[model samples]
Target chain A: MSSNFRLQITNLLIGMCRGTPGLTAELRELGYREQWITSGFPRDVAGRSHPVMVLASRETRHSLFVEVAPGPRIDSDRLLQYTGTTAVELRRGTNLSREQTETYGIAVFGLTEHRDTLRESIEESGVRAALLLCDAEGIRLDVNPFMQAALANIFRPLLPISWAGVPRWIPFDHESGPADIAAAVVPDVVARLLAGETRIDIAEVCREQVLWKLTTEAGKKRLRASVRGALAEAAGREMRKYFSVRGRFVEAATTSSDDGVPLEHRILRIVSRRQVQLLTRLGGDDRNAEDR
Target chain B: MIARSRHHLHDYLQGRMTGTSAGGTAEQPPPGDTEPIKTYLVEVRGNGVAGRDPDFSVVKTLRALVSEPYLKAGFPARVHPARERGLVTIEGRYRGGTPVSMYADCRDPRHWLIHTLAPGRTADWAIGRMAAVGTRLSRVSMPGQLLEKLAGLGLLEGLILSHDRRQFDEGGGYGAEGFMSMQLWGGQSGRILSMMSRERSLSDSVSLSRVHVRYWPDEDDRAASCLAEIDRDGRMVTRGTSYEGHLHLVKVFRRLYTRQIENLESHFRVRADGDAGKLVGRCLTIRPARPIGNSARFCDIAFSGTPPFRLWGVPAQTSGSFTRVRALDLDVGGALDCEVTPEFLRVFLLSGTSANSVVRFLTNLQHYFHSGVRLLDQDGQDVLEL
Candidate 1:
């Protein structure tokens, strides 16, 4: 999702958590583990609680949401320190600054990208797969990829935890499964794809229902070369764009005349192989052989 | 000889083997022709390729039948010389110690498909399907019994046994998915079923004794975990008020000074630009609280309960002249200042062991410093130190 949309939703969630009883109860029912910090230096938000949580909700298909509520109010410097698009820090000194009394905490947020398949989600989530702690909102709060992964495993069995307790007075009868796919195994298929792997079949990977989201908007997204540990044009272009266009760096790169064009597979193929001879020793050797 | 490639069904209709016709002509039979009589057979061929193993092919074909309502072009009904392919993997020792692989080539056709399509056998397979469709089917079935002998109808039956030990869906039977698993219970039951579905493909079937079927989703035999029943041992708790108790003034006041001595000294020096080492000497003091547990009635925090804090004469002291005592920024609101600082008192806290640092912090604070400072992590243990 775009940065703007991500910010709007995150703020909305935080506000709802604080103000709306129904939402808070729902979140708590969905297993939101919010730590209690009643007071701090000047205000509660400023002690920098960073209301962080790793949540997963099987609301639709299955979604994993990781939200780190950065300080509700923070200095510009702190915001810059954690400026990752996925890692957003709240800015301070708004109209609520007076009510906050210069004390506010910012929560950082990171959502695990779409796993789409149930089978894969059961296995891995990149932020330290073992420690991939997910909360109710399908949000994962694993800055450390290793920890995220470890936690993912520890919580895999927990995904199916339901609060509907069976009392002795009740007689039980129920159906086998939902009409639609309710839950799936983890180490989700999309995660495998990002980690340089193919799917069971194109048909399985691309289901009839649901939409596919691109990792980024600007370039050719799926880098087969990158997928297989080869040079990916998109990665280079993205890195180049990140450094040059964003940085104002002199990285011997040029924005193509073809702006507004999404990266295509053909272009990626060309870029992955575009300048091998000039950039590598192997390329130099091949060029020398050609010259000879 | 006619062919029916998936691309175009009519293109391969050579001479139209139209049985519902006016007794075999050029034009294919209309859908209406077989409305009541049901002339066509309904034999479920397990394999699509030649020489396919009858075991899984039969079961998988049954599963597909229940998986959908009608057959599509690629997976069709009634074809000649069945095209089921069975897989084989043989491992044998080679010269290099690596296993060599080879496959057994079979050119024979499956009996289930071709045998049922005999020219005279019309409506034979359909009646069998109609009968089996609604019964509980066990994968471990007697093949001859499975295909009830319809002497007058004249259709061939195969030994279709179910591999699944659990619920199997032969559409609907006594124990089959179609019959038994219509809807699931909610909350705990939902959780269990959802979890089961993820790991296994479950189904049910009717049985002679207990209905059974083959090719059910993997059955996850989950051994339920032992649940813990908790007993709240301590029903005693207080809120919104300070716990009051009597204590020796020295125990309360003396300890308050010593605990704050090191930190207070450092803050004094950092803000004052003074010799900090001479100011904040590690010191110890003692305070008591209402007793509980086998704990020494209190615990230590500042020295990490390790470098064991022990003291006698003075909690802390500097032998230098009292000529200059400078104050910097008010420490968490002058926590260092008290009636004890005539000789620059090094504050220390003597604590009886309480497991709760929060309780210990406040209890020790009441005796020593007479203030509640949330700066310390409930133990009066400073964050910067950790």
Candidate 2:
């Protein structure tokens, strides 16, 4: 299979933009204009050529090399190693985090870049090994505690999940009421995940909670009861976007409008028969562990 | 230079302060004495790297105690190996030409106990110096819950708590911060927690930064008591204590601290070798009261190197709210890859990484992210349990 190739742009960097699918929009928001320059094919240290897009940031006067590897495939080891070294060199020279250290800590964007018009429609059912990402609004299907669980499900779903995790108590921020502190920790989150307990109960956590400096005053009973009611309602409302809840326990939610499969089940069936053929021909590496 | 025994060390300090080596009871203070002698207990967590065993050698630990970081952070001192085994003297002069001397017993490989009889201001300064040294060496960190348990051991004298809900999300600008400190003499000490909780603003976000408790060494003898104030980061100031009383307090403090650190290490130890399909054994799930991912501060606080802790590569942020980066721990030169989300952060141990890095990450997260963040063990239990 022969394809048209561009010239190699050796100094065009790669680590600067690895996991950002919406780089163009993000750069614009950060006050940087992206201008694509016609460059040579990106060559690794070993001289193997790959597709590369070189964009110069107009405001910062710095160049960003984005590698849009098709089919979400991992590049060669030599090229991957080169990117690692380049990232190190950039961080050592100056500080980067302080500049972006406020407001929204980091924005979680989702996949499916078909906001406008699409040339080739990527079929959800046909495609295998999809990336599980997060979003702000709409149905929010989040895989917390362990983001790697999604990866593990995608690559090797049949393998038994042997690990468990400790309980984490998260305190809710109350805008009103007394100053006493109340926190909730979802018990058996890891065990539920391991056992594939899709319908999780988040109510017990809110009801049976750790409270500090709480007084059992007869007059304050109504206030205490109201606070507990508000907490349960808030938790259910916040989690409803991710799952289907009947009262306290939560059931799995479907992926999208067209597909009826649960997100968790869909993730497990990522690598299908059609995708296996494509993967074999392309010699895909098992670097699925590296999410970026 | 070094005092051979505990008694010898006390006498050495006595001579330095009094200028006379009289056989007096170093275990009790003189009556009507406005200037009461006290011992400052400084716990230094050892950096267990291969060759630089700071805990084993007095000279090595002293070298670390007076490193450049300490010097820059107001701990300008000269370290000399003491004559006693596992003992070193850190000597420095205050701005007013007041000479301060501290004898650090490095006998314990894990926790180095520093026995010093200095004035109040000098003692506080020395403790500040130890904190500076911890920035390069190892900082003693304990969860607020454990500190509360320790506070329960004796009558509460004082408590200092500071918490900021806006630090992690305010986009580098100031947000809602609450600081409540109380120094009570008798009755107020017991009800301080409840009294402070009355301030609805503090809520559950409060972190116990420092706690002062007065415990009697001999319960029968009321006069034989010490008011010990311990900071969350492992610095302690014990006033009105003899050399024996200080040692007795240190022993108890050491036991609790060791247990706390050990449990933390076991829980946060991220290893590459795990059974197939298992979630990484343990992870820090931070539920920030407010939503994260709006500002860039999260990356800086998580990736940017702070003094001794270094990161090899720049932390890469996905257009989506995610960060995948490798952190180079300068303490042990170990590398670990970390993935950051708006809610959770986990470290992947690469090579030569130590549990110290995990401890540092949790300790800093409290100050930078959320003080109420809980670290979960493999079995889904809180590791901060006393």
Q: Which has the greatest lDDT?
A: 2
Model 2 chain A weakest lDDT span, ten residues long:
A1-10
Q: What is the lDDT of candidate 2?
A: 0.42
**Largest TM-score belongs to which candidate?**
2
For all predictions, the C-alpha RMSD in Å is: 33.7, 24.4
Kindly give the stretch of ten consecutive residues in candidate 2 chain B with the minimal lDDT sum: B272-281
DockQ of the two-chain complex in candidate 2: 0.02
With candidate 1 superimposed using the best TM-score fit, by how many Å does residue B83's alpha carbon deviate from the native?
26
Q: For the second chain of model 1, what is the TM-score against the true structure's chain B? A: 0.14
For each candidate in turn, the interface RMSD (Å) is 32.7, 22.2
lDDT of 2 at B268: 47
Model 1 scores a TM of 0.18
Write the residue-wise lDDT of candidate 1 on B1-386 in tens digits.
21212112222121122232223345654331221111111122123454655535544544444233322221223222113342221122222232222121111212111111111222222223322322111011111111121111111111111222111122232443322222222224324433443443331121111111111111242221111110011001111111110011112222322233334333322111011101111221111121111111111112111111111010111111111011100101111110012211122221111111222223223222211112232123442223
The clash tally of candidate 2 reads: 33
Candidate 1 Cα errors over 4 Å, as ranges: A1-212, A218-225, A230-292, B1-161, B164-386
TM-score of each: 0.18, 0.50
In model 2, the Cα lDDT at residue A238 comes to 32
